[model samples]
Target: MGGYGSGRLHDGRVLCMGGPWVSAIAKDDRFVAGWVTHATRWGIVRGRGNSGGMGGLRMSYRRLYVPGATYFFTVVTYDRRPLFSDPVNVQLLREAFRRVKQHHPFTVEAIVVLPDHIHTLWTLPEGDADFSTRWRLIKTYVSRRCAKTYQPPGSASRQQKSERTVWQRRFWEHLIRNQRDFDNHVAYIHNNPVKHGLATTPEAWPHSSIHRSP
Candidate 1:
């Protein structure tokens, strides 16, 4: 907010806009949510969702303190609402997630890559922190990668200030609190394929948490 741009981030609306969106950021507890934003038509966001501390954290704060527990994260593609990816693309997305993990040294405890979306349970490493920055970096990188792979059905159209298209700009997340939540999220990600009838059993889906979980 203060460091990167100018004054307070303009209040914007969480518009279910037609373009791509972003997922929630889990940076340090103090400012991660500020980064996860929705698209607004008139540059008007939903209120004080715009608060930045101006200066970037000193080098010391870069190694911020984060809990070692598991956290839930969800991100979606640019309105590609249905799970639509070749095995290769899915793998690429997973690789991108892997890159994100390196930054924080976290374990993707669970993950499900739906045709249009993804859910992950990430556990931050000891001492390292800030899930928000991790999500932001992942979204940016994966979206860029997804753009390269996404080929439109027909001739391409020219757009101003933009060339690539792949993912939405925003996402949602939840910090896993207890055993029930963990089990429920695991079930939710695994059952995603079943809910879509993509497979008779969750294990049948190649792109899901079921495969990652032991």
Candidate 2:
């Protein structure tokens, strides 16, 4: 009934329909404000969008329906600094997760907290949409609340103690292409302590989901 245009996303996936033409594929891309360059596990990528980005790479890799997938999402502290003196920050993070559930509707399969970052596995909710906005809102709220904590150098508000932004304002995400990737990232999150020479077994890590009783 309609026409379709396509392109390949940066991640090397073939994107067929760009816009409203497709019955399944999501939109193209969303924008983030004051975005800068940040390095991710994947490598150096643009952080301008902070969250709410739409790309074939994200939508593709397996158009996982919400509730069906096991996903990996992480939010790190500013410059990787560990400074969550307030438990409220953790609340904020969980609140964001809740809100994400409200919208994208995903079940958190796993979550782990490090001094400076977190890794969470989300199961997509059936018939739901993208989870990018969820991350965007969390980052935005945290950044706005913590703005004063770390004002961009040379900015006019550098003199003030505003939000005390605890996060780096951007994060890395993956769709968990398969079971292996899912297990790998989950193990990475759980066993981070051993890798960092902090603990021996992943179950010994207190900040991770592995420590919790199923």
For each candidate in turn, the TM-score is 0.59, 0.56
Runs of candidate 1 exceeding 4 Å displacement: 1-66, 81-84, 148-165
Stretches of candidate 2 exceeding 4 Å from the true structure: 1-68, 150-153, 157-166
Cα deviation at 86, candidate 1, in Å, is 2.0
| Candidate 2 structure quality by residue, lDDT tens digits, 1-214 | 0122332222223333222222223233231111111223233332223342112133212222232334577767877676444566667666665665564555555677666777776654433335666667767666666556654556445336443444664565665543344456657778776776767887776666665444
Clashes of each: 30, 14
lDDT of 1 by residue, 1-214 (tens): 0001011111211111011222222234234334333222233222222121212122221112234545566666765644255776676776767776555556665677778877766665544446767777766665566664563554266224454456555455554434444557767777877886778998898876555313
Each prediction's whole-model lDDT (CA) = 0.51, 0.51
Estimate the TM-score for candidate 2.
Answer: 0.56
Give the 10-residue window scoring lowest on summed lDDT in candidate 2: 30-39
